[model samples]
Target chain A: MKHIKGIFAVIAIVMLSAFTTVSSGYKIGDIATDFKLKSSDGTSVSLSDYKDAKGFIVIFTCNTCPYSVAYEDRIVALDKKYKGKGYPVIAIMPNNPDVQPQDNMEAMIQRAKSKGFTFPYLMDEGQKISPQYGATKTPEVYVLQKTSKGNQVKYIGAIDDNYQDASAVKSKYVENAVDALLSGQQIKEPQTRAIGCSIKL
Target chain B: MELYFYTMRIVCLLLLILTASCKNESRQNEKAVDLDYNEDFSTVPLEIYDFEGLKPFLKTNTDKTYVVNFWATWCAPCIKELPYFEQLNAAYSDKNVEVILVSLDFPKKYDSHLKPFIKKNNLKSKVVALDDNDSNTWIPAINPDWSGAIPATLIFNKEKRQFYEKTFTYEELETEIKQFLN
Candidate 1:
């Protein structure tokens, strides 16, 4: 009886440890809650600050993701192209520092400087802000438009069609969504499947 | 009678020790197996290429429903839904469904990271390295609307294609596959 009890105790310990590692999944059509983060230049920024703005482009990105790096120029271009039109871009780094230390604030600043990123690249400290947005991948794009209901998610998906070969791209998703919103028309494909490196939880 | 009791007690203690040793050895073996399969492709350089090579694989097979899942070693949601895909593969083995795991891991990590990960997971489905470097060309061809996110899955029959950008449970994946099958 004592031996059986001891064995059961060890098994229970292992099962309990396993439960602590499990993570909850994100869903679609979820509202992106507001979050505060430190910018690459050490300034604090918040999603609520952009509430009165025309629209917002919340891009979950990082320093080391090749897919995110590929869209660096495009992200910069999108900010420049749309900021005047009232849709400023906000880049958020969503990776856990314990797993991806390069995504920390100091490295974020260096990457932004080297890549000439004009927009604010903020660090999602404690990694709480991203999961709320249902952002699971780096380079995931979320287009938010102010509605009577609140800040509604207009579009979510890949930045474009091609990441490795630019010449063969058949569609420009981010640009198209922004264009549709700017034209005061509803975006036909508001949500799209984005492919990139998974954010470390 | 005292001597007999003492001998029996020693025998029981020896048996207990033997059983414990065997359990420890098996646990170690399991750990080694797991270690052998875990691949970390975070630092590898990406292989850059066009989509021309994937043309043959892109064509839909008439009778079978193809499930193309795009994932990487680093994505959390991708890892979360991996078991569902594996379960789908197991459940639909008799059906005309093929689950393809396309690793978007950097090309440099192919041998060391991606391959080991596939093997460690005991993945039974086909795995391919998407060597495309530029997202501009590849994303549009796959779908004009995709904003490159990991944990994305594409289900295609010759006549229809369905794409999902969120993580799935086994039931959800199986339901989508069934729809394609029907």
Candidate 2:
């Protein structure tokens, strides 16, 4: 009876730890895991493909999220401004199409075309990518800096201080992080928070 | 006679100010209740709240445990898990649990989309609209772990506070409530 109780306790502890690892995902300074996902252009995209990229602005955004829609133009603008500067914006659609039918591949392609996106808008089908980065919401960003070992996440959070209005945005978070890396300066603010639609699991 | 005249003028001035203040107070009270009283019973009262307005609703001084669920009309998972919240509210009415549905629906959609959705669903729990334009500040203030995800729930009383960023089944929600209740 005592041995059975000990076995149960051990099982419970292991289960609890596993659950925690799954739930509480990546934090600041953690190395981001690479993923190969289908882009809206029908090509598979991965961070490793960007050979010249000093870093990547990996944004998990979708067509259906109001917050994502609000930031779409800004995302495009960011990619245009920074792609040549060695940091390219890679937008990922992290929502499940079954839960959000409007966020499917067809819709993603349409949205990208409509918005004139310069970035590769990837679709994270089955949501295999966002979880590793700890992305819980649409328009969430993980600014990764390429190091000798791997890509270490320098910052994580919103694109800017304002998601409602692009013109009204006072702070551009992704821009700041990328600029800091380009200039070999420390990122003053490593993280920010925003309200966005939860990535449909 | 002069003193009497002066006193009468002062009294008249005071009375006028008093009446004006009273009228303003009543108008404000009427405006506050108008949404609830004027609307149909099926249509839930939806008030826009900033972080300041939303703060008190999170951590309450009262004994009632508030199960505040952040949701939107467009969010499918939120819609899926809403019935569970409604059921919990219904079942635990006698208990100290209070359910509040905070809708993060767009301001423009309040009339065209959200109001109608609430009416169509006949959401029984207290519903409010959070219209904070700057999400960067309030998301972390609400809970450090929250990524500003919808279908997220904050269950709290005076003693304990728990924030969940994942969707809930009816049973899962009940178990969470039971854990907090204990």
Best by TM-score: 2
List the candidate 1 regions with Cα displacement exceeding 4 Å: A1-31, B1-101, B105-127, B130-182
Predicted chain B of candidate 2, TM-score versus the true chain B: 0.75
Q: Runs in model 2 with CA error above 4 Å? A: A1-20, B1-45
Give interface RMSD for all predictions.
Answer: 17.6, 26.0
In terms of DockQ, which candidate is strongest? 2
lDDT of each candidate versus the true structure: 0.70, 0.79
Per model, the share of native interface contacts recovered reads: 0.30, 0.48
Docking class of 1: incorrect
**C-alpha displacement of B1 in model 2, angstroms?**
86
lDDT string, candidate 1, A55-143, tens digits:
78989999877778878988898899988888899999988766776777789989999999888999888888776675666888888
